[model samples]
Target: MPLALRDAFIDLEQYERLCAAAGEGERLEYLDGEVVRMMVGGSTAHHALTRRLDGLIADRLAPGGPCAVFRETMRLEAGTARFYPDVFVACGAGVAPDAETRGVPGATVILEVLSPSTERYDRGRKWLRYQSLPDLRHFALVAQDQCRIEAFHRQAAGWHYELLVGPDAVLRLEAVGVELRLGEVYAVLPALAAGADDRPAQAAFTPAQVASIAAMRGLPVSGEIEALLAELEPDACAAAVAALVAGDGVGGWAAILPERLHARLNARPDDASERG
Candidate 1:
């Protein structure tokens, strides 16, 4: 079934029921009355990065301290919206364990690892919704494929944005008294090959082309594919498609492609060589 049509117009109650009934390995989030499934699984790099960040943040907080760090399974409630940020921290006397609850009511910092499938929503709609949380002070978006992190800090002057690039760059979460080096965040992942230039070149294919490729591969193309691909160079784009055709999946491509597509394509047989 098309993802969009899977669970349309569900309210908070229905969404909660669906989440409760969901099997262990299933992850679902309610967004604008729709239940969106997170990517089936994260890449090794993605998992490693999330773990590293979680550990780093946890280490900074005193044991049984006022703040607690949580992985993706903990949901954050903002109005009627429920979301599972990749990593977040909740602090202060307001924090408490509620057995009947999946919502963290006092989250002060939130982080998300960027994937091709959900980058658009994470950067736009979700970012906006997360800002509505009364206690949210920091939101950081980490790139799984590159040594880049975009940190948004909520200040009395309003929201501030900072782009930290390169492995040596340091990201300071002043709200939580934690600092993360880009290298540490990207540790264990393969180094990103330098493009001819720092800026992403013009995309070699249009949205139609990407959609056609997905259709040919029996994959579903999300709305973010075009923008994600736009960030890659022509060579990287061609290489990614070639990798998919060669049966290596997105693994052989640069990390810029959607992780979900990579996982799906990796499961399929490589027929490009056979057809050739």
Candidate 2:
């Protein structure tokens, strides 16, 4: 017999009605019958990057061509999911505008700005669903807390993965003839700081300790790499280091640090540490 209760996940028809009743408010996304609210992100850095990329992408594209850029205001469907990508490029004919939402005509490229809470979902489930779209030629993940991008481009055989690091790294989508420079993309961000997505809202390590750790990682370390140490939670190879930092209030943790980092940063001759 059919179940007496309603379904856990809604169908596309139900999703449309929900969108209609949603009216004007926070953005909503549907995936595999689940509705998710687009909250817990929208950081200042996220907004700044989104705005800057919009300008850069728009500037590079020829004006008034079939190819065009769309912001978060636009929505696209992939199999059973609907996503409001931070920025996307669609070519060929345009989807007719609607009252509630503007559907994507054909998404050739999609880029999403990663946030702490939503990073997993964006990279995993959402990414899998997007593959169902036949026109999606390229997809990129923008790291808000650092200068990095993970891009995937569709190929005849399968998808090709490319990791772009450092400020000089360039993102090129051959399908649409689009290129994004990392330096220009990260200009909106400040000089340097470790990525805080894996950490609490506040920084976990002191500035001096971070610098010291950066030096030990390698002589004349890259500032980008230095800023990334704050996000790396070491494996449970060293419990003593975690205890010391936890008690000293140096790294702002009661426990949870790498023994290697302790041997390197804690043994510095300039042991005088200053908190950020």
Residue pair clashes in candidate 2: 194-227
lDDT of 1 by residue, 1-276 (tens): 204426458788888888889888777877789887786568877788888889988998878768889888777777788788889998887566466756777589999988777776675567667877898998888877667777777776556566677767898888778888877677656464232225543343344444445444544444445445555554455444433433423323233254545554444454432222
> Against the hidden true structure, what lDDT does model 1 obtain?
0.67
* Runs off by more than 4 Å, candidate 2: 1-7, 192-276
Over 4 Å off, model 1: 5-7, 190-276
Number of the top candidate by TM-score? Answer: 1
Given candidate 2, what's the lDDT at residue 184? 81
Worst lDDT 10-window in candidate 2 = 237-246
